[model samples]
Target: MNWVVFAIFAYIFLALQKGFGSLISLPEAFGGMAPSLLLIFGVYICLSARAYLALWAMLALGILTDLITTTNPSATIIGPASLGYLLAGFTIIQMRGLVFKESVFTLAILTFSAGVFAGLTTICFFKMRSFSWLTNDPIEGWDSATQMYRYFMMVLYTTVLSFPIGALLYRLSPLFRFHEKKSY
Candidate 1:
């Protein structure tokens, strides 16, 4: 996988995720969850890239996520999302051989599954941080149940959006150059 291409896509996806979040978000009555474009792209990377490349991509995506989603600008903690993406990427790499990576449906399913894993891991990291001696809270709301529900809803929304997006991305797979390095 080409790091330059990966970085370009990462920037574009992150921009879309943040720039279009309000437009892409569900109604307030429905938990107001926004589809995570980054997660979908990250899933694509994990499914297509070789194991080592996938790990690095996931880490980069995670760090990007951490940087952007920081609630408090004064104190930025960057490990939660980074670790979450790494773990999710690792899990997907382990199971990639069992899935049909080229299928859009497979991409949607894996996106949701990985989204759930990474999202929950991120929440847990923040929750643990809240309990620590840190002066500032990492996350705004400490309501675990509500946060979990919202996160799940966001993942579901992202999964729904992944079908068309994944198809397009898969069509552009050659440009990404992942086919040559794909793990058999």
Candidate 2:
């Protein structure tokens, strides 16, 4: 994988996600779930990249996710998301061979599954941290059930959005140079 190209794409996608996410998200009444562009990109990488490369790429995406997202307005934690993403990426890498990598449906399903896994893992991390004695805030008083509901909703939204986005990424896959090493 070309790290430079991946970095460029990551910056662009993360910017769009941060700048325009709220505009595309569901209303607050429905938990305000938004499709995650970065997650879609990570899904693409997971499907197409080698195991070693995909792990690192997913970690970068996870770290970026941690930087952009916060359960609390004033506090931003990092380790949960990175670990969650790494775990999700590992799972996907292990399972990638069972499906057709080129299918948009595969992308959607994997994205949803991975999203659920990663989201739940992140929630668990936050919940665990909240129980620690040193922390004062507790995820803005949101119960775990509520968080899981909202996260599941967000993953569904992201799955729905992944069709078009995944198709586009498939079209652009050559630029990622994932197949270059296999050509000869």
Candidate 3:
């Protein structure tokens, strides 16, 4: 994938995530979860590109996402989001050959699973950070039950949103021309 094009898309998604993400919300019963558009996009790109390219892309995306979205005033620790995204990317890339990548159902499942993995990784990091003596900035409202519930809801919401986004990406794949055709 062209770095320029990827950067453009990254900026756009970041803007949407930062500016308009709150405006869109799930029902109150669902904890008003907003879908992670950036994660969805990252997963889509990871699934579409070669493993090597996807690794770098996911790393860049993850770092940018952490920089943009982190609520910590100190910005002390940076690896949680990046680590989560890398793990998710690696898992998807490893499983890529087993699934039909072009199928919306497959994409949704991949997105959902990846989202859960990323969410769990992030939660674990936060939990560790909260307990560590080195950090003054511990995660507030540290209820494991509530956090896990919210994470599950967010993953589900992200999965629901991924279908359309995946379809759009697949439709525009010809223009980007990132993925290579597989030979028999």
Candidate 4:
């Protein structure tokens, strides 16, 4: 397993996920939604043709996400996100035998469950950086609940959409080539 090759593409994929997630925002403000491609990509990479290379690649991707996603250099959101990615990766890999049989049922369940796991982690990370969690008033608390609920609704909605997208993207064969790693 060539980790360098894996790292290069992993970095690119993370950047794409971050940029595309932000770029394709809906009029209803779907910023809270991640297309689930990232997680599925991570799963694909990890469980792809090369497991070790993909795992190391995913590690690099996580670090890159921490560096680039938020204006905050020390991204508070990336921490929980990193945690979830790590935990999910470990769990997914530990239970890796299922990849031998790629059925629609299995893929659907995996896609949805992994999508939910990744989405919840993102929601928790983003929601933590806010004023809504600090309110003690009952009325304000109720209002915040509605907002959070709405966000979850959107997240789930996007995750559902991510199923076909992730599956379709996974079917594509990646053409590996050299690309410069631009220095910050």
| lDDT (CA) per prediction | 0.86, 0.89, 0.80, 0.52
- In TM-score terms, candidate 4 sits at 0.57
How much does candidate 3 score in TM-score?
0.87
Candidate 4 residue lDDT tens string, 74-112? 323446556556555665566667665244334445545
lDDT of 1 by residue, 65-95 (tens): 8887754656768998899999999989988
Q: What is the TM-score of each candidate against the true structure?
A: 0.90, 0.93, 0.87, 0.57
In candidate 3, stretches whose alpha carbon ends up further than 4 angstroms from where it belongs are 73-77, 132-137, 179-184
Worst ten in a row by lDDT for model 1: 132-141
Clashing pairs in 4: none
Most accurate candidate by lDDT = 2
Q: Which of the predicted structures, 1 or 3, would earn the higher lDDT when compared with the native?
A: 1
Candidate 1: stretches off by over 4 Å: 132-140, 179-184
Top model by TM-score, which number? Answer: 2
Please identify which of the two predictions, 1 or 2, would achieve the higher lDDT against the true structure. 2
Model 2 lDDT tens row, 30-144: 7887778888899899999989999999999999999999777787788888888899899899889999999999999999999998999998888876676756556668788
TM-score winner, 2 or 3: 2
Overlapping backbone residue pairs in candidate 3 total 0
